[model samples]
Target: MSKERAQRRAEREREAAVLAAAKAAEAERHERREARRRAVASRLPKKRRGPSGVLADRRRTQTRLLVLAFLVLNVLVWLASGDWAVRILALVLTALVGPLVHILMTKN
Candidate 1:
């Protein structure tokens, strides 16, 4: 009975040692990764945009999404109508939109 108890205790100790070693290795790896990330980040310049700049970026993104939706809808319209006029209109609008958005974004 005593021998069995000693064997069980030794087994538990071995498992505990293995778990501790794994944990230490994981921590070391995490630390190394964090150090590398910090080093890389330090090498890059930070881009700090003000409130209006942020708002403009947001607006630009919204405009792009809107323009994309418009183009898609117009394409569908052209496809459905199977008309040359519809295709030409869609093409003209799509061509003008990006520059128009850029102009509008830049002016404000």
Candidate 2:
């Protein structure tokens, strides 16, 4: 019985050692992959958008907002008025004024 117990203890120790080795290998592999990724990322070019790019983005945002506002206002007008003539008039006015509004808002 004592021999059997000793054998079982030895088996358990062997399994523990194998598991520890596997864990260490996995940690090493993870570190290697992360290092490679960092090296590649460091080589990539950094995007530097200057003042013109910023201004262009701002103008684009303003234009989009203006278009959204125009659409919402047109919808409101259509809902508020039952007359077809009033809806048509609203559409015409929006078409005429939209470009002017865009130009004024986007002008530097």
Candidate 3:
């Protein structure tokens, strides 16, 4: 009875050691992967993050506003006018506004 108890205790210790070793290996692997990811990220080009970034964000907002305005204008034109010529004219003008605004905004 005493010998059987001793054998069971030894078996449990062996299993615990095996589990601890597996956990240690997994932690090491995770650290290695994180290190590799950081190294790769460090090599990438940094994004613009100052006044230029602010200007870019502002420009994007302006562009979206322009698009929304043009969309609303086109919808109103189509809804208010029954003439095909007027609708086509509004579509053409809306298409031209995007490129013209882009050109004006990009001028330095």
- Alpha-carbon local distance difference test for all models: 0.83, 0.95, 0.89
lDDT for residue 40 in candidate 3, whole number 0-100 = 95
lDDT of 3 by residue, 1-108 (tens): 999999999999999999999999999999999999999999999776655587778877877887888899999999999999999999998797777977786566
Clashes of each: 0, 0, 0
Candidate 1 stretches greater than 4 Å from native: 52-108
Which structure among the candidates has the greatest lDDT? 2
Per-candidate TM vs. native? 0.49, 0.51, 0.51
- Lowest summed lDDT window (length 10), candidate 1: 99-108
Arranged by lDDT with the best first, the candidates are 2, 3, 1
Q: Per-residue lDDT tens digits of candidate 2, residues 4-107?
A: 99999999999999999999999999999999999998999987975578777888789899999999999999999999999999999999999998898788
The number of residue pairs in model 3 that clash at the backbone is 0
Off by over 4 Å in 2: 1-52
Per-residue alpha-carbon lDDT of model 1 for 13-62, expressed as tens digits?
99999999999999999999999999999999998974588777887787
Candidate 1 displacement at residue 100 in angstroms:
15
